[model samples]
Target: MCHMTACSLLSYIAIAWMKMVPMQTIRSRVQFFKISALSLVFCVSVVFGNISLRFLPVSFNQAVGATTPFFTAVFAYLMTLEREAWLTCLTLVPVVAGVIIASGGEPSFNLFGFIMCISATAARALKTVLQGILLSSEGEKLNSMNLLLYMAPMAVVFLRPATLIMEENVVGITLALARDDIKIIWYLLFNSALAYFVNLTNFLVTKHTSALTLQVLGNAKGAVAVVVSILIFRNPVSVTGMLGYTLTVFGVILYSEAKKRSK
Candidate 1:
């Protein structure tokens, strides 16, 4: 949770820096609102994603996140009226199955955790769809930097209150930072920089790739993050989980090939 919060703060700072650069193109209030709303969805998703992480192992969390392509397809279908091929639909089955298998037999299900994961996935899907629409309509007017700038500060509206009320020790940390916790300050600074990079990558990826493809790649990210966490944080990794990750990677590669051929 702390990691997620730190990431969020970093993302916001990145967005703010992007927004500072003046752009010749102008957006209407409605378009700006849409972008802002999308940012809010992103913020909410990260929060829920973090919360879900507490109940499930990091491996499980990433496995579930591997289903992002499935959610992205759903959202794209609903929002853009984009219809995926039957083959594409079929591809998700193995991916989802792999996630279930990776979860190590659902070790004592937590309803809230499951819900949070689903919410995060849904939010990510929605963001993809909405962003696609916005970019298609107004992309020429908005560079990635401008988009980040507008989005970063707007996210603060949601992040600030939530962090203040929900995060117990956040206030103390903030005070300590003010009082000269150089390490904490450094941590926060580094996190903020990482957040910006992630956000930038997200925008670039979404702009260049299909939403479904981007989401599919997101699975790989989850798997990698999980592996890193396991090695660094000493998180448990079961045999089934390893097998599941392998399957997911294979399925994602197959799906990517299919997408490329169709294109």
Candidate 2:
């Protein structure tokens, strides 16, 4: 939960900063359409992703989360229609292996859960690549906050109905929104905020870093999230799981080093 809390806090700060920053005019309908469509896709991804979480174990979820890089790689390649080096392809091996290992053994192989996770991963990956492309093409015109301002309103539209039906009793929810529940509220708020930041950061990072490096570092998020989840939830930490997490982190470090050397 602390991991979630920290992520949430960072997200909130990002969102707040986005609000404070002035945005350029939505000059073209095409840009507006792209933002709306992409934001909606992201909203759907989050909804499905959240639902999948209920059926999947935390370890499984984290492992699936770690697959984002692979998905991102695939999406980026398809979008760009560019072939990457052999080392880039090889890097995915450790990432996949680490995820399988860290998932507390093999996943249960639930079709629905697996599908949801896969869809969520693909959606997120596509969104990242699209956002990167947008940022690259329109860097001066579209600031980070502009992306948030555009995305958030669309997210609210997508999330509001779901919140009403799935998370009904807003009054009760509001009542429980106390200091003790600060963590939960913070997490939700920050998660929403971070959703935007992650999109923005992906653009910046991909611009500055290699795709493989961005992906590898992104995979580490799962390892960090898992470790944090284990500590906070007092989960049983198995030897295999520890080994897997270690490998995942190591792989990320290697990928980062490779990027540095290449630069």
Candidate 3:
């Protein structure tokens, strides 16, 4: 929670430093409400994502994360009334099935963690869809930096109450941790930087491409994470688990190709 708050704070400061969006314009009632809704969805995704990682191995988390494209496609169509090609929809079959197969073989899988991961994935998809819907218009559209400027402060506001309710003595504990190990502070600073950049790039990419395209790229990220995590963490991954992960990657590739040809 502290790390996420730092990330949100960093986002606001960086955007404010850049002067990407006028602070005054952010007060428009309708725009503020829409962006706030988007921020809430995004915060839910981030929170659940963190919770899932605490219980699930990174490899398993990424494997399940590979299902993002499936959810993205579903939400995109529902929200936009934009039907995809039949082949593209069909491709999601294996993408979803692969996760189920991987779940069965995941040694470290916790049911609660699995639920949280799925919720996170779904919320992420919803966020992407909502971003496109609410902010894609000529009148409302803001560039990536400006979008982050508006959304990040709202994320910080939304996260504050949750952090207080959940953390018990978060400030004291964090201060103690920082006091005990200066390295922890640096680690958090590093992660907060990564989070801010990750979000900015996600918005930039989504602005340039469709929501599904971002998730397709994320599919490759999941595959890479699986490989790197296995190498670094030496996770006890089963053959079935690897196969499921492989299947999910293949499905993402197929889905991407189908969408391209449809275009």
Scored by TM-score, the top model is: 3
The window of 10 residues in a row where model 3 has the poorest summed lDDT is 18-27
TM-score of 1: 0.83
Give lDDT for model 2: 0.66
| Candidate that scores best on lDDT | 3
**TM-score of model 2 (CA atoms):** 0.75
Reference-based lDDT, each prediction: 0.74, 0.66, 0.83
lDDT per residue for candidate 1 within 1-263, as digits (tens), equals 34434445554454455554454344577877887888789888988998997887676777778888888898888777898887778778888888778765555446789789878988988887777776566443465656665676677766777787778787687877768756776776677777777777777788787778778888778778877877876766667777887787777887877786777
Error of 2 at 30 (Å): 2.1
Give the TM-scores of the predictions, in the order they appear: 0.83, 0.75, 0.88
lDDT of 3 by residue, 73-180 (tens): 889878788777789889988988989899998888799999999999999998988787655766666667667766777788888887888678988987899998
Off by over 4 Å in 1: 1-26, 138-141, 174-181
Clashing pairs in 1: 10-192, 19-149
TM-score of 3: 0.88
